[model samples]
Target: MQKEELYKGMNPLEAAVSGAALEGAVASGLSDPFGSLDLLTIQVTPLAIGIRADGNNFVPIIPRSTTMPAQKDLIFTTAHDNQAEALIIVYEGEGKKVEENHLLGYFKITGIPLAPKGVPEIRVILDIDASSVLRVLAGVLMPGSHQPVNPVMGVRMPTVDDGHGWCAEALNRAYGSTLDLVTVHKKI
Candidate 1:
């Protein structure tokens, strides 16, 4: 195709690039102008995904600009010593605090062996599939153990469809850092 046909009323550089693109598309047998038929295109996360940690902080596991079909795990510890149970409250947004973000879901990890604060390891994983579905998994683990003592809990995200703010608020009102977790730096 001529440059005039593919890029009408365009400057020389723009017309050349446009004509080349059209030729490349036709040469490659791409039926869609947007190239949606490509099977391996990338999609980025619309919002940051993380958990509610100590001091009411939003500790991000999968950052907002991360690509989809991503999985990330963060180590967290109990806020108080001998805290036998912890809450894994997931949120999605660009909030520095949990209250500013949307509540995705939550699960409680019980049956933790009693230990001093930050002694036990809690692995919280956030995964986002290419279809934009989010899954959260949390479990308690002993140091140097590859497996969890208790069964890991996996929860699909957006457990609250709307009024998510109130759900977060209600959780705070009901638990108020009693079951809070603190982020433990990755040792490896």
Candidate 2:
């Protein structure tokens, strides 16, 4: 959808607050306390509606984009319930084996009142960078090369070249699976 369609004239703050409340409710219902929210199931609507928190109303909107490691921006109204909160967790891969440590960002909305959970709105913008995949793999293969706070003895550190190879291998391994390299930008 178009950017204008997402906003529907609501200001950033209004979008952020409403989005956060809906997200907070979903987070509260998850089976795993620390699990990331599933992006595939989230339905994108054109306008905000009467999603209530405490006694207030809210509206949420997610932007449109075409890229890997999708970026999301959420906005909603201020909420009253302490239980009302929002969080964004980034994971590696599309399956159960995805790494949680790869989490890139997290956001929360607190101090919302119990009565006016629906009045105010909120806005959130998210951008996902997959470059860390390379870094993480490099660290795993060349343990000492990058240098962690406490390096264990007898551990071999791989060089930057090795990291590059690992990154390529990872992309290859994911070939025909969930990973594919695409030309994101073209020279003018």
Candidate 3:
């Protein structure tokens, strides 16, 4: 085998030993070189993921630069009166508007049991692993209900390519607030 080829195929342990030997040979009392360097790599989220809120705004659940294997939950409510279902649209980006972001995917929680607007509590849970796989959980809680409805959908991130804005608009046009949700903000 060629000398360069033989050296290029060195295993991690072998490369570490050789690098240490070279560093020792180059060591000098002048100053410690390679300082302020990170020997280990840091894990981070590639994109900011969040749900759409009122006024079509993007409410970030997990912001960018967050470490991996992160999870977050946000409470939401129906946008219209006596809503029976809530649609959750998940997007990924740094943009404040959902139209400017990429739609990862969405799920709907039905059988909310007829409640006034902002009365039913819909919980949106986002779970992201180190591999960047995202799983979303939507739980709808209504008064006097035995349990939350089923049809819980979990999907991988980045489910859509182009035309995400059009998709959102179409969904709204078809559903007409039947699956709309808004962030539930409490004062004090």
Please provide TM-scores, in order, for all candidate models, with all chains considered together: 0.76, 0.22, 0.69
Q: Where is model 3 poorest over a 10-residue stretch in terms of lDDT?
A: 29-38
- Each candidate's lDDT (Cα)? 0.83, 0.29, 0.75
Task: Output the better candidate (2/3) by lDDT.
Answer: 3
Segments of candidate 1 deviating more than 4 angstroms: 1-40
Candidate 3's TM-score reads 0.69
Candidates 1 and 3: which is better by lDDT?
1
- On lDDT, the leading prediction is 1
Error of 3 at 46 (Å): 3.0
Tens-digit per-residue lDDT, 60-127, candidate 3: 88889889889988878888888876778888898888878888777777777676788887878899
C-alpha lDDT of residue 157 in model 2: 18
lDDT of 1 by residue, 1-188 (tens): 65554645669998779767766666577888677545444678878889899779999899988988899999898889889988888887897987788888887889988988888888888888877898888888888788897998888876683754787788789988889899888753
Once fitted onto the true fold, the runs of candidate 3 whose alpha carbons sit more than 4 angstroms away are 1-39, 143-153, 186-188
Q: Tell me the deviation in Å of residue 110 in model 2.
A: 3.6
Better of 1 and 2 by TM-score: 1
- Count of backbone collisions within predicted model 3: 0
> At residue 90, what lDDT does model 1 achieve?
84
